[model samples]
Structure formats: structure tokens, C-alpha cells
Target: MMSQYKSVFKDETKLDINYVPYKLPHRDRELRLLTEFFSFILHAPGKMAQRIVIAGDVGSGKTVLSQRFGMNATREAEKRGINLHYVHVNCREYRGSLFLILYHAVSVFHPSFPKRGYSAEELLQILLQVLDEQDAYVILTLDEFESLIEREGTEAVYKLTRLQETRVNKPQRLSLICVMRNLKILEKLDASTRSTLQSNVIHLEKYSKRQLVDILSDRVSLAFKPLTVPEDTVSLIADIASSEGGNARFGIELLWRAGKYADADDLNVVTPECVRKAASSIYAVMRKSEAAYLSLHEKLFLLGIARFFKESERAYASLAEAEQAYAVVCEEFNVKPRSHTQLWKYLRTLSAVGFVKTEVSENIGSRGRSTIIYLPRISAHELEKELTALLEKDV
Candidate 1:
């Protein structure tokens, strides 16, 4: 039985979601900006604290980008005789507790550090004192920082941003890279914290299909055996992920799942069928459950959006276009179409539930402003099929 087992993965760990590649394709500019922004720590350590915000949507490479930069920056600092440490704290895991966040950072160096009995401020001071005695510095990355603000409110932001104020006349020992899905969360912060953070912000846009292809290709080379994954399979995965806001994570997940399917089936190579199976397994159930809650008009409205994408083969469609398609769908269903106001309400509701994404476009020629809609996680073609089957059953 052991001899019959066939595997295609050269190093499975390479496909791990948390694994940060040494080279990040299509993120050179962002990485360069990070290097420049934090260069102060290497050139003049302990002179001043640094803080920057990294904003991007899900799967926009925020966490990996920061980790990559931190890894490289620490190595460079070490070469220059600076003892710089990199600490990445996921705010979601700590539930945005200020004390817990600080404790985690300290525990990285002092594993025996007590977990309780210290206020946030006191923990912060202790952390700083430890760093001072060791003559070390840290580049602290707060991932999912919005969680911190949501749970602890603006006070958490204020405390982290104003760390330098606590140790006046001493060398700054901590710099911060706050990562969030988007900077809109900053609106809840106090003016001082917002202004300080807003001054240096790095925005990472979603990866394009070609970019995702390159990324997946790189991972495949390291994760799978030679010639096991063909170009067609990689392209299919990229195509599927591109429909979902060009999410690289989704693309990578598909690739990994495809490989797993190949291995489980004792196949020598990963095929397009494996990718399809992977995609369906990942989101089909969730999508169905979510769509099941929609009312009839809501389903019809979503079906219209899906049909618009199917017909236009475009990434985005105008609100007017979607409404027009929706009207057609309503006619086909033998139901009266909702007014424009009601359709707008449907759009909002669908967007809130993650069925569709919308943005206001200003450059619509004669149309001053128009709402642009696109599917975020599911492919339009697949969504169309799903909604159509459900609508027919309802009828």
C-alpha cells in the first residue's frame, strides 16, 4: 500500500497560506516603499519612532508584504550591527486587547513573561525597558488592525501611535506597521491618531489575472514536482480567481487544492478538472447557503447582475446596465420589475451580504456618476447557473 501511494508535492509547506515567498511578484513598488519608509530605523536607530499604515482589500497581500519586508529589513539591520526584531501580531487573535498585544510582543523575547497582572501601559513600559536594556529595536506589525479599533476603540490606536511620547529624551525602540483591509476604519480614530497614521499610508490593490498567474506559477515551481502542473491548469485557476476581485489568496488556494486532489487520486499531474473540483468544494456550499436567504426580487436582481456579466464578459457593469438586465429578468419571470429606487435598495442589500460589490465611477462620459457592480468572490458564470436553478425551483 505504501509503494502504491503516489505524491506530486515536492515541498507541501510552500503552499501554506502563511508562507511568505522570498520574492513577491507584482509588489516590487510596495516593497520598495516599505524599505524606504523604514530605512530610518537602520540609518539612525533609536532616534525616532516610525509608523505607517498598509491598506488593502482581502487577499491584497498586506500581511505577506509586511512580513517579507520585516524579514529582509531585520537581516539588513543585523548586518549594520543593529539588533532589530520583527514582531507580527494579529489583532483578531488577541481580540484587540492592548495588554495582550503588548504581552505577546514581550513574550517573543522573554517567553517566561507573565501573561497577567499588568495594565496595558505598564506592559508597554516593561516591553520598552526590556528593549532598552538589550539595546534592541522592533518593527511591530499589527495585522487586522481594524479589529483592534473595533474592540478597544480609538484609545488603542492612540496608545500605539503615541508610544514615543512615553519615553521622551530616549531612543525610540519601536516602529509600527498597521495593516487593515482599508483605511476607512481610520474614520473612527481620534484626529491626532488619524493624522499621524494618514501621513504615511501604503495602499495595495488587488492583483490582476496575469499577476496572479505569475504568483501561482512561482509557487507551483516550488510546491509541486517538475512538469506536474501544466499552463492550462494554472490559467484556469487564475481565471476563476480573477472574477473574485483578483484575489491572489483565492488563486493560491485553488492551486493547492488542485494539487491535493491530484495526489489523492494517484495522478501524476494536476489537471483542470482538479481545479474545478477544488473551486466547487471551497465555495459551492457557502454560496448556496448565503443565496438561499435572499427574497425573490433579491434573487432576480442578483441573477440580472450575473447575466450582465455573462453577456458583457466585462469585469464591471454600470448600475443602469444591471437594472436594464434586471428588468429583462423580471419580464422573463413574469413579474413586475421594481422601480429604480427599489432596485437601488436591492443593490445595497446584495452588496452588504457579499453577493456583489459596487463602486461609484465618475468618468461615465455623459453620465456624471454611476454605480459600477461586480461579483467579488464567485464567478459570474457560476453565479448565474446557481441563481437560475434556484429561481426555477422557486417557480
Candidate 2:
């Protein structure tokens, strides 16, 4: 029998690094821009690193660009004999504790990394001491920076900003690249501090379809056999990414998934149709980070609804079936199942978070209507995987 996808599946468990681009697209422009911006700090005699903020919607390619800039900064610093201790950390992952982040910062530049028995303040002192001794400028890039305020409030944020205000007979020489997923990062800062951040705002816009197409096409050469990926693969991936709100990560992921499907079916050629089949699952998981923070009971409730609809194949699932399925998941997780009213409220929360769609439909015989919960896409397995990963991190 002829199979649809046979050739591309060398290893299903292959790491995703193969798909991630090492260098950013049109990255030289950003590198030059940031170089010029950092020049303001690097040239500032011992105390003038102005605050810079990077703003973009989720998946708009901010972090990747920032890292590329970070890499360039290190290269330039070395060329000019400028001492710089570069550190990159994602705040969302580190939002639970300021110490975890500082630990990461100290650990990056120091061989020992001071793993045992240091308070956050102690770690900061050690980091600054290293900086003073080395006469090094610090270029720290903090991604998902808004999470700091959301999770721990403003004490850390204000304190860190204060560090930038220090002067050795000049301005605070430390530079920071702060990334936020939303504009509210502006509101979180005081007026004087926001003014410093405003001077260096770099907005990473969503990728255009052509941009995503080019990205996927370029990677295809490195990732797959020549002429193996059909032309429509680019458009298929681009359309899905754009329709899902211009998510570059989503585009990269869909291409990865389509390759798998093609390989599994023993097809030598990757086609748009394969990507079409794979994108639903990709979209499902792309939004799971938002779901991860929901209460476990809420997750079980959503899981129950997802299982029911997945089994039923209809958009609208009966509350009765959903409740039963939910109960099963709660028992498996060893958590108490909530009542129907509480479950419905959970459904509303999920909808608000864009996990599921909901509608009201009348029963065949009953006078009143029941709430019908619908999956945002055909399957939410990816979503489940995302939430599970996030929960696992907390555990």
C-alpha cells in the first residue's frame, strides 16, 4: 500500500532546536539598532546606562530578537575591550521568587554560581561585587517582565529600578533590556522611571505572512530534503500562524508537526494538506500557558469538557456528559469534583481565557436551555500538554 508520509520521520523524539533559528530574520537591523542604543550606556563614563524596554504582543518575536541583540552586544563588547557581564533570564518562569532569578544571574557569570545558602540580597551583593571588581557593565535581558509585577507586586521592580539610578560621579552604568507582553507595563512604572524606559521603546510587531513564509521556507532547506516540502507548506503554516494572531512560534511549531505527520505516513513529500491536519493540535497547545495557572479543579473541569467533546465530535457538549467525564478526571487527580454550578463558572473562566467556546442550546424536550461548551479547535491535546508542563514546573 502507498503511504502518505514515510520519509521525513527519522526520529519522533528529536529535539526542537533543529527547528529554532539560530539567527533572527532581518536581525542585522535590530542588532545595529540595539548596538546604537547600548552605545549610550557603553560610552557613558561609568554611570549612564539608560533604561530600554521591549514591548510586543505574545509570540511577536520579542525574546528572540532580544537574545540576538544580547549575542551581538557580547561580541561588540569583546571587540572594544569593554567589560560586560551579559545575563538573559525569563521572568515568567522565574516570577515565583526574585532569588531564583538573581541566582541565575550570579550563576551565569560566576563559575561556582553560589548554589548554597544565599539570600536574594546576598546574591545581589555578590553580583554587584563581581561587577565592581571586574569593572564590567551588566546587560541583563528580562523577558516577560510584566509577570514580576503581576506575581510579586512592585517591591522588586522598584528596587531594581533604583539600582539603575545609582551613580559613580556619573549615571547608573547598568543597562537592562526589559520585555513585556502587554502595554500595561507602561502603567506599572512611575512617571519618572517610565520616561527613562520610553526613550528606548522597541516594538516587535507580529510577523507578516511573507515573513513567516520566508522563515519556514528557509528552515525547510536545513530541516528537510530538497523539494520535499511542497510550496503550499509555507502558505499553510503562514495562514495558520497569522490567523492565530501572528504567532511565529506557532508557525515554526506547525511546520514541525507537519513534518512528523508526513514522516509517520511514509510520504516523501510534505504537503499543505498535512499541515492542515496538524495545525489544530498546534493551536490548541499554543495557549496552554494561560490555562496552567487555573486551579486544578478548574483544569479537571475543562479536561472533562474536552474529553467529552473530543469523544462526541460535536461542538456543543451536554452538561451531564461533561460532568461525568469531569468527575472521572477529578478522581484520577484525587481532587474533589465541583458541583454543576461551580463547573459552569469554571467553563466561563475557560472561555474568557480563550480555551473553549460556549453556547446556549435548548434541550429536545425541556423548556429551558442548557449551556453547550465547544472546543476552540478540533482537539486540545496540545493545550493539555502545555498546562501539564507548566504544572510540572511548579510541582
Residues 67-182, model 2: lDDT tens digits: 76777677767777877766778888886467887778777668777578977767766777777777777888877887766775566666566674444453354568888877
Which regions of candidate 1 fall more than 4 Å away from where they truly are?
A: 285-395
- How many pairs collide in each candidate, listed in order? 0, 8
The TM-score between candidate 2 and the true structure equals 0.65
Candidate 2, position 389, lDDT: 60
Q: Which candidate gets the maximum lDDT versus the true structure?
A: 1
TM-score for each predicted model, relative to the true structure: 0.74, 0.65
Question: Model 2: runs farther than 4 Å from truth?
Answer: 1-23, 26-28, 40-47, 111-119, 170-173, 283-395
Deviation of model 2 at 27, angstroms = 5.5
Q: Against the unseen true structure, what C-alpha lDDT does each candidate score?
A: 0.87, 0.68
lDDT of 1: 0.87
